[model samples]
Target: MNYLISALIITLIIPIWGLLIYFLNKLLYILLSKISSEKVAMTVVNYLTIPGVIHHELSHAALALLTGAIVTEFKPFWPDKTSGSLGHVNFSTRGSLFTRCLQCTFTSTAPVILGTLSSILLFAYAANNTVPFYILVPMIYLIFSIIIHASMSFADVKIMLKGIWALFIAAYIICLYFQIDFLNVIRLHLIAQL
Candidate 1:
């Protein structure tokens, strides 16, 4: 029962954590704008999150290409305060509506998926290996940083909603059903590896 509760908590927190990070970024951006120019605030945010932004845009581009979408514009670090977009990938969707919607949803949500996978690998690696204290600290920091930036921005979510929210929901449900103890599996795997 405790294990089940723990898994439930972990499952709930994953999405909520991403959303909290997204909203926190927005709030910080707004507050910073009051103290300085919007561009400066946005620049600061972008500068601080260069690694995440690069990963985000790369994932977007990769998924876009995989979906056969033409990525017309790709900006890894061009923050736009006016548009409230930290970085963007402009791609044209084609094919039937379902295919277009799936492509759009996948492209927009790739960052979170990839970031989570990266974070999991880092954690698992750290668990499986012995490292010096200093190195371990930085490794832990990197994992946290990846998680912090793993969430899609409001713009990304909006694009996803415009695509096919139902499809995404159904996919999520299917994944949930098959991986009800996903967190526990990760925990167990780490334990075994350690």
Candidate 2:
């Protein structure tokens, strides 16, 4: 009986996550997107991509908190309302190095991998679950995120990959120090460039 409840919850949890991802992706696609040259698209995609990164980062923080990792806060990325190309967000952590690493991986990879995984899980549930919404929601999120994160001819994949790695490393360090801030760092660097 315990096994049955555990299995049921496990099945429900992932599909629910998938559902959230699906709606989130759609929301991002609608708002923070436009037609641009490959160069411009690439530039924008890095920092001001969409609302999806919020989903990714929040997922990481939530998972960490669940596993007893100390998480101070997290923020989502949105258009500067001034311009695109600014990925400003607020987050902090206070956890052991190991827990922080786990948190980092979760936060960094959630949009790309778990976001993808969430979609896959939904599709799987759609194959067997009675609630078609279970599958539909996440499928949408997966598609939108994949598109937003994708390198438009405007941006090169090599550059994007480097940014991803940098974000991953930053997540770890952020988790280690509760006050370390990447959002302010990013904003300052952008200001300098301008």
Candidate 3:
């Protein structure tokens, strides 16, 4: 029972955080637009989020390769006229439905996972070591940038949510049968080790 609750919380937290960041980013974009031309605002926004954009797209590509999907198109920052994707990865979907769906879900959610890990590690390192002010400020900015940008677009979520139920069921079975609190294990090992 406790493991079930933990699993649910772990599964839900990242998506909620992503949605919050998505809305916040949209609001910031609108606010920026009011101060400048839409084009300028977009450019500025993209520039500010370059690090996140790169991380987001690279994560997709990396996962695609890992899942044996052929990555055909990968744009870290493409100014496409029609698609509103600031960055994207177009990969072949030739796999078992379960594998494809799970990979897609992981690919879409990779930014949050990677960004949070990166931020925590950086913070831990900074705390453990005596860092200079100049280095510390940029590190802080980078961490915040990653956090603010670690959200998937609606389209990305839609693709993942198509098989979300299946993923949930699989998670439940794994946790219930194994009596494993996966989240607690991750929190203890990954976070504590840092």
Candidate 4:
């Protein structure tokens, strides 16, 4: 069925998008390092993706707080070579098992959710062609910066995997509440694209 195919395509898009971002990040770092010292390359890349890093860390902290976790430490843009992280958030894991799982899963995945929403809004605005050239230029850069860092870090993904069941349940509940036929929606969107 077309709906089945569309669902399959939708499922494939997430991993493909993540891989594309990962490769692009690695390629940028490699190219920059070839032209300068490794440290300099790292710094340049960090600065370039600063907006996304800030957004990513803030999303984690915000969602952690919202989910009844106490944020202990928050670093928006501290590039740690040892940890290989651009930023991080530490939160207290004091809650029931289900609550803790939900907190971890939601907090870890917040960046991708918020970043994707932001990118969609930005793209819609750009598509309208109403903004001035000066504003549009920075908007494009911001969109690129946000997207490049939207993918989860390894640690985030690990945390998410530990509580992925919570995410699935939450997603299902949301779809139910919204009266969404997930496969049908995907099928319609795919047809619209074509």
Candidate 5:
């Protein structure tokens, strides 16, 4: 029972945690603009994005190359204060949208998603077929990583409002369907510890 509740809380917090980071970036951007020029804030966004963009695009390029496609050019978008770029990288696709999208999704999310899956599988093996372990450890790690990466690379007010709102609504529905009391459980256990 405790494990189930804990899993629910962790899952729920994942999205909210990502949202908080998104808000924090905007807050910092606003403060930087107040102190100096908007260009400075713009510069900051680009700086933050450089490494992330490189890694993400590298993943895409690697995938395309693996598929034996010609990656003609890769251009990481030059950062500017006028636009938000955590360093944008483009892969010149050499195949159908299906292949490109597959590469894109795998490139963007493989580390976190696959890593979490591995962690879950490990826990499952180690825990000796415990039901609670089936639900808890993997979910906590998976959602936590999702929150981290999503916050860093995905979440933003600049993103589509409909998409963001829709995802949130869907996630809540998922939680509800699983009969999870996420917030209350977290407050009692995890939040207090924090």
Candidate 6:
């Protein structure tokens, strides 16, 4: 059915986009490195993606606090070649095992959630041609920048894996609470598109 196809497309969009961005970023770095020093290439890439880095770090910190975790340190932008990290949020997990797992998973995935929402809103805005050309240009750039850095780091993934089971349960509960029908929603979207 159209709805099932739409649902499949929606589910696969994030991972596909993440992989594409990852490879493109790596290729950009390699090309830049060939043309310049590694350090310079890194610096250029960091500067280009600074906005997303800031958003990503802030999302982590925000979710940490929301989930009852204590954020001990927050760095929005600290490019460390040795660590290969643009920024980091150090949070102390609180609550029981379930709660802690939920906290870790939510905090780790905040960037992707927030970035996707942000991109969707920006795209909606850009779709409206009434916006001024100047504003639209920056909005498009910000959407691109946010999406490129929306993926979780390896360390973040490990942290999330610790609590992914809890996350799934919570997600399912939320869907139930909202009476969400993914297939219905997607089918409606498909109808609208047609």
lDDT of each: 0.72, 0.46, 0.75, 0.76, 0.49, 0.78
lDDT string, candidate 1, 1-194, tens digits: 43444444543453455577677767777888999988887666667557777777888899888987789999987877588566778999888787788778778777777878888998999899998899998888777656656787767777766665435454555556665555666789999998
Residue range 101-184, candidate 5, lDDT tens digits: 434433433333333344456556656654475776655554433323334245222222313333344445666677667556
Candidate 4: tens digits of C-alpha lDDT, residues 1-194: 44344434543454346546667877888998998878888776678769988987888898899999899999998888797888889987668787888888778777776777888899998998789999999999888888877776667778876766665566556555665565777679999999
Query: C-alpha displacement of 102 in model 4, angstroms?
Result: 1.3
**lDDT score of residue 93 within candidate 1:** 88
Model 1 residue 183 CA deviation in Å: 16
- Give per-residue lDDT, candidate 2, residue 99: 50
What is candidate 3's TM-score against the reference? Answer: 0.78
Off by over 4 Å in 3: 1-5, 34-40, 177-194
Could you arrange the candidates by lDDT from highest to lowest? 6, 4, 3, 1, 5, 2
Q: Distance (Å) between predicted and true CA of 30, model 2?
A: 19
TM-score of each: 0.64, 0.38, 0.78, 0.77, 0.38, 0.77
Residue lDDT tens for model 6, 1-194: 44334434543453455456666777888999999988888776677778988988988999999999999999998878798899899999989998999899889877877888888988987796588889988888788778777777767777877887676566556556665567787679999999
Candidate 6 colliding pairs: none
lDDT of 2 by residue, 1-194 (tens): 33333334432343344445455544545454555454554444444435445555555555556545565645555446465422332334346665545444344334445556554665676667675567676656554554354221112122223234334445444544554444555678999999
- Candidates arranged by TM-score, highest first: 3, 4, 6, 1, 2, 5
Candidate 1 residue-wise lDDT at 10: 43
lDDT of 2: 0.46
lDDT of 3 by residue, 28-146 (tens): 78988898878877876677768777877777788778867788999887756687667788877668888777677766676767777877898999999999999999888777677
User: What clash pairs does model 2 have?
Assistant: 22-137, 22-141, 38-153, 38-154, 39-154
Weakest ten-residue segment in model 2 by summed lDDT: 150-159
Candidate 1 runs further than 4 Å off: 1-17, 24-45, 132-138, 165-194
Question: Which candidate's lDDT is highest?
Answer: 6
